[model samples]
Target: MTTPFRWDLVTPDRLGSMLDGALAPEVGYLTELCRCAGKVLARGGNGDLVFVGRSLDSMFDLLGGALEGTGHRLARLPLSFWRGYDYSRAHVLRAREILADLGITPASLARRARPVTFVDVVSSGSTFRSLFTLLHDWITEERETWPVIRRKLRFVGVTSESKTSPNTFRWQQHADWTLRLPAASVVNVSLDRPTWSYFADRQRKLTKSFGPRRWIDGPAEIDRDDKTRQALAEAVRLVELGRAREVRRMIARAMEGEPALAEAWLRTLRSRLS
Candidate 1:
């Protein structure tokens, strides 16, 4: 199935009537998103940020808006995978094909210039685990260089903000597959609870969810109803904010405390954002 069409922020003028009375988005929603974006860049090791699903679409828009001319790679992978679900052979094959089309196959991962970091709003992290297991198994089946690909793959989970204590539950630490990658490959960024829940649970979206059931369908149909249009407007506004100089600086500032700030690549990216 074909990917859904998201509005192009570069030519908003072309969408004149669609945006004429569009919903006024909550402009103040940027703080949590921008903070998380900075950490996505800082901890992403200056690599491509691939949003794993629809939940983080707004964050992707925010970054894409601000990264307009910086040569930074930002993208979205629409699959909505879940752990502990059995898949039929046809479904698995189609999923693999989709991954290949996104240039996420073993060969591409091995030759990429920078790492590919997957970002998503996470709860139990079942989605991340499911996607990782598929890729790991596919790499082994293809006999690709695991050692080379391991370093180039990374994951960043956007979790609900919580105070840290030894007893605090951390999803990555409890997942067995995490041991397969380098310790630093799996990291996290937190957003306040209200905003986190809003994104993961209640946000309006323009496209149908691409779960396993929808894998073999025809091209996705975009919904142009009032809700979809309003969602589109909010998304468009996010990109505009990203293009602002002060907003870019704010996102860059969020990176100041990340440990990745020490790396030259991350340092260069921070400079570009600033």
Candidate 2:
């Protein structure tokens, strides 16, 4: 499995962000994003967060920065499960191997008490559905404790912010496979429209799409054009923002209203953040 070529910003391998000094960025969206991140963590019981694909890279970076020194977990899957691929047995095996590396195999799932929550920006929730199918089939084939493993799996979809109503289309409710998971295993966090489009459609990611076609290829090759460079700089800034004391406090405070706040685990974490 080929990994992406992302910079190790935490390690300070780069000299500068390469952004213009004179340009002042409007950052009203950050507060909302921190709230969303906090909700994602609280909803997942603050378990191991594994963001799926590039759409939520900003959130991943933000949380990664905030939780760097803490015991909280953060990771990115980078796997594009957009379907329509005729994956060979070898391809499937390789994909499973990658998942196993992340301690996501059936045995590990059953063994570990902590839930692994996969985060992603969703529209139709096709990516999440495809991922669930893959893991479910693998667990079935391996004859593992599906009952236990299912409980340790979770999904947080970042959907577009909208007016709340009874007719609002929720993907988890519409999906048949969600019935297999324990209640509340699949949840959602919403983002404003502009910010949602920024991540989902406009941002030029530093890594190439890790789709079925590129699994066996060499290290991820990404373009180094001006747009991508600008995006990279913005990403670096987001990471730094996440590391700020106020932002961490914001994250902690944002979890106050979540249902998980009643749990001792979350309260302990909130105390630590404060």
Top TM-score model: 1
Per-prediction TM-score:
0.94, 0.92
lDDT of 1 by residue, 123-142 (tens): 88899888898899889988
Q: In candidate 2, what are the lDDT values of residues 54-103, reduced to their tens digit?
A: 99888887887888777888777877875667777777777787788777
C-alpha lDDT (0 to 100) for residue 178 of candidate 2: 90
Off by over 4 Å in 2: 12-28, 218-220
- Model 1 scores a C-alpha lDDT of 0.84
After aligning candidate 1 to the native by TM-score, how far in Å is the CA of 176 from where it should be?
Answer: 0.5
lDDT of each: 0.84, 0.82
Q: Which candidate leads the pack in lDDT? A: 1
Window of ten residues with lowest summed lDDT in model 2 = 17-26
